[model samples]
Target: MSAWIEMISDEDADADLRAALDLARTPHGTVDNVMRVHSLRPNTMRGHVVLYRAALHDAANTLPTWLQETISSYVSLLNDCGYSLANHWKNARHLIGDDARADAIWAALEARAPERVFAGAELALMRYAEKLTLEPGRMVAADVQALKAAGLDDGAILEANQIVGYFNYVNRCLNGLGVSTAGDIVGYYAENEAE
Candidate 1:
């Protein structure tokens, strides 16, 4: 419930901000707390939603949605953003559809042994996300080479990089702003079940 930025309620938003909020609403008919925080600057929030949608949800994307969610969950875990971790892990579970595999992936990531639960392109992608999140400056061409070796093309690799980078940026925003997980997946599911 604690947010460094004041949470903007839909009812209290200015007309323009309401328009921006409309673009940011979740499936449960509530705007994300992250977006509510960003609503402090409607224009920036609009730009953020545009970039976010393009980066993560563009129709032309080649990477499978499950892999994208995997990268997001891993990056969030690496950054220790509980809000993003919980939501993205829920997404990964929904897309992946195996609770044990999802749990193993999270456990492996936590243990720094992703290879135990992932292999081939999946393992490579996980390693790449780890490097991109933890030591971007030290990244070398061999890292991309590993992804290529894992059967990813240049375009897919590029998309993976963007997804990893996006989560890092977003995780920082959520973590730094003290945004709680109050209205994330758990709450969304709870509300749906009650309805």
Candidate 2:
């Protein structure tokens, strides 16, 4: 499905917006529809690009990139956002490099029973993600304590928190705008997010 609103094209962008669009471009050199939704406000688009890169692609994140991709897919699934789910699932599959393993994880995520495939700190974080995504108001400090008890240090918990929050934000943006995987290349920007 196309966006519910009009999106600005590269031809219509000024120098500054053109720069922002450049950063958001897929490897195909075209802006993905989700990022294009922010074209009306160049600054917002730029912020999205920066946040996305840092949250999921930054080398400094202690969480493995594959795990981040899985977290993104999980959040999208919770939000019923096909665009982000399909895109990040593809990315996660490629990074995981084992079709069977990735499919098992996908199965668990699809079942909304992360415990089926995850354990320990990973399981705790997935549970936290579910609670935060589905019941933002019900969360309490006990959630953080649970993560800590599961062996996640404060830094890892924060990283997982940022990833969950980022995917929730992206999921709502795409869902609210009617973004879909129609013409976009699934996972095209996964490895090339730094541009």
Candidate 3:
């Protein structure tokens, strides 16, 4: 853990911060360590959590929950954030059910992923995410063209890009802040390891 951040000071929370925390507690079982630290600045943490949850709920792409989690793992791999990787990896198994597919997706992502899992449309979205996350400046007219070739309309592309960007942003924040990976999620992955 980074020496810079201390866990949130329970005794020192202001009224608004407490409210934000109260709101946060309804969904998350407990105040996560990362959330606890962020609770020191509750409003910001509230906004971040709200937006993240909303992004997950947004119905933009046709990818299944498990597949989305797979994409998230790929993003986490590139970002090198254990927090993001652990949660999404667990989600992939829990929501997607097919452990084989999750492992396959990870393998493909680590390798440059030639096969398209969702559809041509989702392929374009994943490719766009890879480009945006790995080499934003290198993205060019050709990238958009490829998405078009895969039959994604402008609206779907926009949503996909937003989701990718959002995850990338959170990955960076968590990485920089030294948030610990969830131990239960870590155990879940270990339990579900591919044979």
Which of the numbered candidates is closest to the native, going by highest lDDT? 2
Q: lDDT at 191 for candidate 3?
A: 50
Give TM per candidate.
0.91, 0.92, 0.80
Q: For model 3, name the residue pairs that clash.
A: none
Candidate 3, 92-149: lDDT as tens digits: 7677666787666667777877364556866777778888999999999999889889
lDDT of 1 at 78: 91
Order of candidates by lDDT, top first?
2, 1, 3
Full-model lDDT, candidate 2: 0.88
Clashes of each: 0, 0, 0
What are the per-residue Cα lDDT tens digits for candidate 1 across 1-195? 358878777778899999999988777777777677787899878887887777788898899888888888899989999888887777777777778877887789889789998899989999999999999999999999999999999999999999998899989999999998775554233345467
Which candidate has the top score in TM-score? 2
Give the alpha-carbon lDDT of every model: 0.84, 0.88, 0.69
The candidate, 1 or 2, that scores higher on TM-score is 2
